[model samples]
Target: MFAIAVRFDLHDTAAAERFDELVALTVPGIRAEEPGTLVYTPHQVRDEPLARLFYEVYRDEQAHAAHEARPATAAFLEQVRGLTRQLRVELLADLPS
Candidate 1:
């Protein structure tokens, strides 16, 4: 499986609200419409208002690429650009189960 981990830092409560809005509004669409997506989850650090994480899983590299190409993903990216302070993305190969 292929995985994507995104860590984001928000500058303030407002930024965090925007982050939350994007995740809630966009993720379901990605999961429902993208066949290649195996898992899609958004998380916030416990009691930490400024930190956010996204955990994504796909069947393989092709699937991962497909997810990246989806319109919903693009929209989500564009929407969140100014709403975040710092964002980091990491791609990983899943360990054997």
Candidate 2:
């Protein structure tokens, strides 16, 4: 499986609501369109109010590539452009079970 863990700090707490709204729109669209997407989970950090995280898992490299090519992905990226103070993403390869 292929996965990615994304973490970010927002520019301000006020941006959190807009961020949530975009995620809500983006996740459902991805789920419906991408059969190879195994998981797409979004989290809001409780203690760090402006922090957000997303854990995404795909069936394989091709699946992940396809996901990035989706329109929803572009829209989501655009929405986050000015809202984040810091952003980091880690691409992952799951170890054998």
Candidate 3:
């Protein structure tokens, strides 16, 4: 799997709310269109009112590329541009199972 975890620090609580809403809007398209996207989940960080987290898992590198190439993904990126203060993205690797 090609996976990633992202931590988004919103500019303020209000921005967090807007960001969450945008995430809700964006997810359905991902669910319906992204067959290779095994999981794409968003979380409100505990005790951090202005923080959001996302965990995304794709079938492979090509799947990740396809997801990023979508117009909806571009729109979502544009929508969230000013809402976040900072974002940290970590590319994840599978562990021995």
For all candidates, the clash counts are 0, 0, 0
Those runs of model 3 whose alpha carbons end farther than 4 Å from true positions after fitting are: none
Residue-level lDDT for 46 in candidate 1: 89
lDDT of 1 at 42: 90
Best by TM-score: 3
What TM-score do all the candidates reach, one by one? 0.89, 0.92, 0.95
Q: What is the total number of backbone clashes in candidate 3?
A: 0
| Winner by lDDT | 3
Per-residue alpha-carbon lDDT of model 3 for 25-59, expressed as tens digits? 89999999999999999998899899889999999
Candidate 1 vs candidate 2: which has greater lDDT? 2
For candidate 1, the per-residue lDDT at 61 reads: 86
Q: Estimate the Cα RMSD of every predicted model relative to the unseen true structure.
A: 1.6, 1.3, 0.9
lDDT, candidate 2, 1-97, per-residue tens: 8999999789886798889888888888898999999998999888988999999999998999999998779878988988988899999875789
Q: What is the C-alpha lDDT profile of model 1 across 23-91, one tens digit per residue?
A: 889988888887888998899988887999889898888998988898888898888888878999997
Q: Which stretches of candidate 1 lie over 4 Å from their true place?
A: 95-97
The lDDT for every candidate, in the order shown, is 0.86, 0.89, 0.92
